[model samples]
Target chain A: MDALIEKLKGQIIEQLNLAEVKPEEINPDSPLFGEGLGLDSIDALELIVLLEKHYGIKIQDPKDGKTIFQSLRTMAEYIKSQGKS
Target chain B: MDTITSYAHIKHNQVSVNGEIIFQSYPSLSLPEFLSEAYKALGVSYPKFHKMDAQCKLGFLCTEFTLNGTSFLTENDITKTAIVLSNAASSLETDRVHQHSIDDKSNYFPSPAVFVYTLPNITIGELAIKHKITGENAFFVSEQFDAGLLVNYTETLIQSGTEASVMGWVEVDGTNFEAFIFLAEKQKYTNKNAIFKPLNKTSVITIYNQTIWTH
Candidate 1:
């Protein structure tokens, strides 16, 4: 789980173009949206693409995005539960 | 006769305002480097400037310089200003960059950030959003600079009730790029002693042609 969260940080930084952000700066348990990463709706769409391209995890329901994308930890847990991580 | 009150022209590594050269750099600098240097020289911080495509960056920088000296107009009046710009490439260079991201499904990592700027008029949209302009806007793709078309269209808009217009040519393709933006308004002052040039096709052509650096 720790390894997965660390990988997710790098991927998120690269995918969302947080150019000045470093992997160590993102807290695994903190929120991914709003005040945390300050990501907007467009970044959310990119995150969905990131999930499909990396983990092959197709989000079945749009509502699931709210919980699954809550944090780097939650995203890693969701991917592991799907056995795709 | 409407008059062109202010203008900015940027070609090669040089930046000019109202036909006078203001900034120039070494010939070896790349487009991105030169634009960054220009942004720093402008001494304003708009973080979104760093994320823009080359076309938007060029248009943004030129608009900033052209309007920088125009403090006579209030923000409310400025918001009513219209923009009409022309370019040959029409975002083709940014299109190529975006295309490379989705060329192969195997290596594809399509980016929304890149995909958003694929349209040429998006440069105008960026300007509108940045400057809070809500007036009408148009972007033209042509084989070359059409001063007559620009002057005619801008005059029609101003005559139809647009307060003023910022019209120019901004072309960016690969390493070749140039921008010429000017402010146009109906002749409000008819004093025979006034020296400002009228915004006719010939004057527009001269302003654009003045930036041509002979190799």
Candidate 2:
């Protein structure tokens, strides 16, 4: 789980073009949107692509995105639940 | 009288405002690096700048520099300001990237962020959002800079109630890029050192050549 969380940070940074952000700076338990990462709708869409492109995990429903992309930890857990982690 | 209060030119390995070079690196940096450097020199922080594609960046920087020269937007009714720009390649640079992503379903990963900028007019949208400009806007695709078209269109817009306008050419394809943005407004100018030029075809052509044809 720790390894997945760490890996997700790098993927998010590259996929979102967060060039100024570092891996250590992203808190796994913090929110990925709003005040946490300050990401917008575009970044959320990129995160969706990142999951499918890198982990082969497809988000079956749109509503699930709210909970799934809530944080780095939530994303890692979702991938694990899908057996893609 | 409508006058071009200030302008920004990007070419020959430098970025200039009102004909004065503000940023340039000898061993020309990569396009991304060059734009990042130019954004830094502008001394303003706008996080959305990083997410834009190359073409949008060119136009964004051009608008930033020209506005830096005068209080054109602040002094005039921002909602009455307009943006009229032209480019040769359009958004082909980002289109190529988007094409590659969807080239094959087996290896497909089309990014929504990248896809949003596929339209050349998105550069104008970026400018509008950044400057809160809600007035008229248009994006033209021409084989070369069409100063006559810009002048005619902008003049028509001004006659139709546009109080101010930022119009010119901004192009980006692969490593080649250029931007020449000028401000046109129905405001009195008293800057003693201003390069007083009316928004006419001859004057527009001369300003464009000052940087584009200098190479």
Candidate 3:
């Protein structure tokens, strides 16, 4: 779980072109949108593409992204639940 | 009288304001590196600037520098300011990236972040959002910097109640790019430090051409 969280952090940074953000700075339990990483709608879409491109995880419902991308931990857990982690 | 108050030019890995060299990284940084260096040197905190494509970044940085030379915003209602810009490439750089993303049918993923900047006018949208400009705006794609078009259209807007304007050319095609942005006003400024050029075809052509030929 720890390894998966770290991996997701790197992926999110690279996928979103967060050049100023280091993987270590992203707290796993912190939110990915609004108050935390401060990602917007466009970044949310990019995160969706990241999941599909890297993990082969296709989110059929866009609404589920709110829960899946809540934080680094949630994203790792989602991938683990899909057996991709 | 309508006058061109302050202006900035970006090219050859250099950023100049009002015909004076303001910043340039030695060894001529790559387009991305140059833009990042210029943004850092400008000392602005627009977080969304990170997500913008090359074209928008080029225009955004140039506009910021142009506006830096004057107190136009503080003196005038920015909401009534018009923005008229022209470009040679029309977002072709980002268009190619978006096209490549969807080209491989077997491994296709079009990024919304990249895809949103597919249009040339997104550059204008970026400036509008950043400056809180709610007035008229337009983006024209021409073979080169059409000084006549820019001068005519921008002056027309200012004459028709637009308080001030930011106009010029911003072009980004692959690794080749340049931007010449200037601020113009509806009336002559009485600011002790203000040095404005007549908003006419001759001055526009002269400055825009000078920047183009400058290294």
Candidate 4:
């Protein structure tokens, strides 16, 4: 789980072109949107692409994105549940 | 015809406002690196600028400099300001970056942020959003700088309804880039004492050529 969370952090940084941010600074338990990473809608689309390209994960429902992408930990757990972690 | 009220020319390492050099780029820095440094030097803190493609960034910076000392006009009547920019590349720089994103079938990851900038006119949108400008806007693609086209279009917009126009030739491909933006206003509001050239094809072409060639 720790390794998965760490990997997701790197992926998010690179995929979003968050050049000023370091992986260590991204707290796994913190929110990925709003108060945490402060990413916008466009970044959400980039994250969706990241999931599809890296883990072969296709989120069927848009509503599920809120829970699945709440944080790095949540995303990792969701991937694990899908058996693709 | 409208007369030029303000202008800025930006190259890789230097930025000239009204034909006067104001900012110099570090020769050692790469294009991306120089842009980052230039943004810092300009004391602008817009985070979205970091996400923009090279063409948009160049246009944004050029406009910022063009309107630098004209804060009174920009702050008072932003809605009256229009933008008409022409370029040779027409977002080809961002297209290349976007193409690379989806080209690798094994590692395909098309970024939405990058994809949004695939259109050249996106720079006009960016400028409008930044300045709250709701006036006329247009983007043209030509083989080279078309002084006649820019002059005609800008003059028509000014004559029709718009009070002023920010005309530019913003072209970018990788590290090689050039941007020259001029703010043209009707003769009624122009100051006689101000050292501004009239908005005509010959003068515009001369300034444009001088900006690129002198560098």
lDDT of each: 0.84, 0.87, 0.88, 0.83
Per-prediction DockQ: 0.41, 0.73, 0.77, 0.59
* Per-residue lDDT over A3-85 for candidate 1, one digit per residue giving the tens place of the 0 to 100 score: 99999999988777675578998998889989787777878888898999999988989899999999999999999999998
Looking at chain B only, the TM-scores across the models are: 0.92, 0.93, 0.93, 0.91
lDDT of 1 by residue, B109-154 (tens): 7788888989999889888888777777999999998999998888
Which scores higher on lDDT, 1 or 3? 3
In model 3, where do residues sit more than 4 Å from their true spots? B189-194, B211-215
Per-residue accuracy of model 3 over B1-215 as CA lDDT, tens digit each: 67888889998898888777888886467899999999999998887888899999999999999888578888778789888999888889999999999999999999999999999999999999987888999999899989999988987787688988889999998778999998888776454654478888888876775553345
Please state the Cα-based DockQ of model 4 relative to the true two-chain complex: 0.59
Clashing pairs in 1: none
Off by over 4 Å in 2: B189-192, B211-215
Ranking by DockQ: 3, 2, 4, 1
Which scores greater on TM-score, model 1 or model 3?
3
Candidate 4, residue B37: lDDT: 73
Local accuracy of candidate 4 as per-residue lDDT tens digits, A1-85: 9999999989888888787788999989999999888888999898888889889999999899999999999999999999998
Docking class of 4: medium
The global Cα lDDT (0 to 1) of model 4 is 0.83
- In terms of lDDT, which candidate is strongest? 3
Q: Return the TM-score for candidate 4, rounded to 2 decimals.
A: 0.87
Error of 4 at B46 (Å): 0.8
| lDDT (10s digit) by residue, model 2, range B85-152 | 99999899999999999999889889999999999999999999998999999999999989999999
